[model samples]
Target: MGNIALINRRNFLKGSAIIGSVVVAGGFWRAAENGVFSTGKGPAYTAWETSPNGLDGLVNAALLAANAHNAQPWLFKLGNSSIELKADTGRNLGPVDPYLREMYISLGCALENLIIAAKENGYSPIITYFPDQQDINYIAKIDLTTMKPLHMELYDAIPKRHMNRGPYDTTRDITQEIIVSLMNLNIDNSEVKLFMFDSQQDKLKIGQAMIEATQTLISDKEQIGVDPKWTRQSWQDIEKYKDGITTDAQGLPTLTRMIAKILPPLSPEQNNQFWLNTLKNKHVATAAAFGFVTVRDPQDYLQVVKAGQLWQRLHLWATTKGLGMQIMNQLSERRDREVSLNLTPVFGEKLREILGTSEWHSIIQFRMGYPTIEALPSPRRPVKDVLVSI
Candidate 1:
């Protein structure tokens, strides 16, 4: 293998180019002007800002769904008896998410959580996707005036679903029964397909490829810039820009998080060793299993959003089962349409073949198992923050 130092140096330029584009495009200025950097659920907290029975409350529950970078790239317009979900164009991630695939998936996640909450609170949500051809930002409208609340079991896990990034307890086996339950969650015959890798060999294959993907990611300066933008390095920054990733949310030990609070800000470029070693030491290699969500059409916007919805549902389901999941999908977000990862062409091909969908692209992947301890909750933007003036 090549030297880690050499690899880090090599990819720094590529990553820098992406960051430069974001700066040149004024992503930072726009984010700042729009107060996109702001974080924390202020005052009574967005979850309790409204009752669990109305559009506002439903939107609040949706706000808790996981999103790429925790950017929460969505806005809501409360209607007479429905809610409008729109993309927050102001919260850009530069070149890392060039086509905004992650953004739409994020909207879908919010949409899923909203539906679950709505159903539990006695309102039926009728979804209309891409309601307006002219306005691409108009994702969907949930009309809640027609039906009665049918409490779904997944509702309780809405707020509790989290992405745990720390090491998992390998001894705590995720039994076949639980795996079957998770697999059954693919009740919808959609274009998206979900697969779980439980075998030691499959896990090892993915674990190794993930290590390669991280090397590719760490070398790219643009991706580096993209990360620090959504990562709060200090306690002050965490409370201020309440939406980005923080140490506490990262599955770091309580003491480590405490130390992090007082230490000087850690730069994203200084991420070579940690990123490179994590896969082998903590993720796919040691987790209970690796899971993937693939789509027939990687370029299809609606399909991608639906993938996010499916992810949130499964993630919440995992939460209710007392399991934790960690997403490690750098391979899927590659610019190439094929499964070609940074490692070898054959590696991606193997993943596609194993999933039994040679033509489909893996949209997202994650590691799941029981956590050794409880995880810290990631902060979110208050409901009022995402409300668009209508």
Candidate 2:
């Protein structure tokens, strides 16, 4: 909160004017289809489509959630009247996420999806966190009992919801009604606190801070180097693994997505400028509004997971509202093995001053706006891949 300078309002307005013209002139641009999130049915639910009922389908629905670098670090153990979700420790991000905070939060996103899918498809889900204290890997067990299926828009939105990191319409403002709706979503999850910023000046501050965090991550060879592990380059690799971050998920234009396909995999060391420029556009410059999330304790495992469940609900609700959200979490990534990663301390202090609460630590940050196009959804691993036989 200290020594942060205000941005020039005139420049902000001018840039917004240009983006507004582009969006107004062209409307939501559609890219040539490569079979990701097509216009017809949207992203394929290979996992949920086959069964649509039973444990495998449930896990398949959960798999559709947003995750860390799209790692999808979770597994499902079939249960008679329940489905157990455990951390696939194999998917850990090491020092990049030293405490496995993102991993657990990712699991929470998945769990939220599973619960909604359960109810929509006629199963009543009762979730119990850390069902086995002896096993830290045991995130939660969702007890599924029979119920009369209740049709809901969120069930349809589960597949439709995705991170839109591309350029967005600047002239358009998020209605006060929408902002209030998003803020009120996590009322039941008392541990989660959200701070929303719709003002241009506030957005600039978050953008500047996020840019710093992004620079920090890419500057360190070890951190940026580790990122490639979860980044899929070749179409062959993305198709084979059916997981990890892909070029299409960046919300790039059709030309760029196609150009990316032609090139060989570039190392993060070589792409520092590309990463910086891309994120500046995606995270800072083009976004309409930004917000951050904080929980009671950053280190509490179950709290982190429940926070994620809350996030999933808000995300799906946003989807129903026709708003797109992208999580800018580099501010929360660890600088080393130490808790309260130094990279995020500035944001924490700033949040403390802004939110007027000293009890919460920042967990996730996001930008939401009206997009000019519908980017293809990221791919998911088949249900068989994550289902564990017990």
Clashing pairs in 1: 11-219, 15-220, 15-221, 15-222, 16-221, 16-222, 39-241, 39-242, 40-242, 122-149
Candidate 1 per-residue C-alpha lDDT over 259-336 given as tens digits, one digit per residue, 9 for 90 to 100: 334334444555456556655676665688988887888778888889889899899898887889977766665443
- Which ranges in model 2 have alpha carbons more than 4 Å from their true place? 1-45, 48-51, 334-356
Residue-pair clashes per candidate: 10, 1
Worst 10 residues of 1 by lDDT: 1-10
Per-model TM-score versus the true fold: 0.83, 0.84
Indicate the TM-score of model 2: 0.84
Q: RMSD to native for every prediction?
A: 9.2, 7.7
lDDT of 1 at 292: 87
lDDT of 2 by residue, 183-227 (tens): 888765577777788898888877887787777666656666666
List ranges where model 1 is wrong by over 4 Å: 1-53, 335-354
How far is 369's C-alpha from truth in model 2 (Å)?
0.3
Candidate 1 whole-model C-alpha lDDT, 0 to 1 = 0.70
What is the RMSD of candidate 1?
A: 9.2
| Model 2 worst lDDT window (10 residues) | 1-10
